[model samples]
Target: MLKAIIMLILGLSVLAAGFITLKRELSIEAFSISSADEAKSEMKNIFNDQRWFYLSGIALFMQFVFQGFHLTFEYFFYAFLISSGIQSLFYLFNKKELDYKVCGVIIVSFLVIYL
Candidate 1:
């Protein structure tokens, strides 16, 4: 049915975004390793590694669960918005640069779905 197809597409798109965000975060962490090593001269703690990725992944997974429960495009869209907001908050907390373009994409995608 149309609803199922839309949900599938939305889920896949969100998952793809999450994966890309994770990849970017990992790359940044790798870049920061040298600086961190110079500061501490010790092995990095895994708990402190790639925190944004973990947080974003959790938020995205929660969105996925919410979407799956509703089976409606609107719910999926809202979930995406909420997930993006959560990710933005994580970025803010980490004092890292935020991507307004990515946030715009999420918001625009949700508006499109709502329409």
Candidate 2:
């Protein structure tokens, strides 16, 4: 019962972290443009940014982690693996630097969960 409760809390916390990161990185208020073309251009620029892919990968990984914790470990192991791989790929794609340390902790946790 305590494990379940803790899982629920952590799941929710991961989801909240995802949302907060999204809000901070992609805030509409920050893109105050006077023209439609400029708005479209800005949108295109934002989407084209490598951070978008990095964020998407992170969001995917975190979402899987949250769902995995909320449900059963056996069921979400593949999902966790796929999402974690994608996250790592995105991180690698974002920059040549090896900055995939963030997903390392998540992969380790999921490995523990798998065992």
Q: Which stretches in model 1 have alpha-carbon errors above 4 Å?
A: 30-115
lDDT of 2 at 1: 58
RMSD of each: 9.2, 8.6
TM-scores for every predicted model: 0.31, 0.34
Candidate 2 stretches greater than 4 Å from native: 1-10, 18-31, 49-98, 101-106, 109-113
Full-model lDDT for every candidate: 0.50, 0.51
lDDT of 2 at 5: 51
Candidate of highest lDDT? 2
Question: How good is model 1 by TM-score?
Answer: 0.31
Best by TM-score: 2
lDDT of 1 by residue, 32-76 (tens): 545755656544453454644544444454545644544555554
TM-score result, candidate 2: 0.34
Q: On a 0 to 100 scale, what is the lDDT of residue 75 in model 2?
A: 40
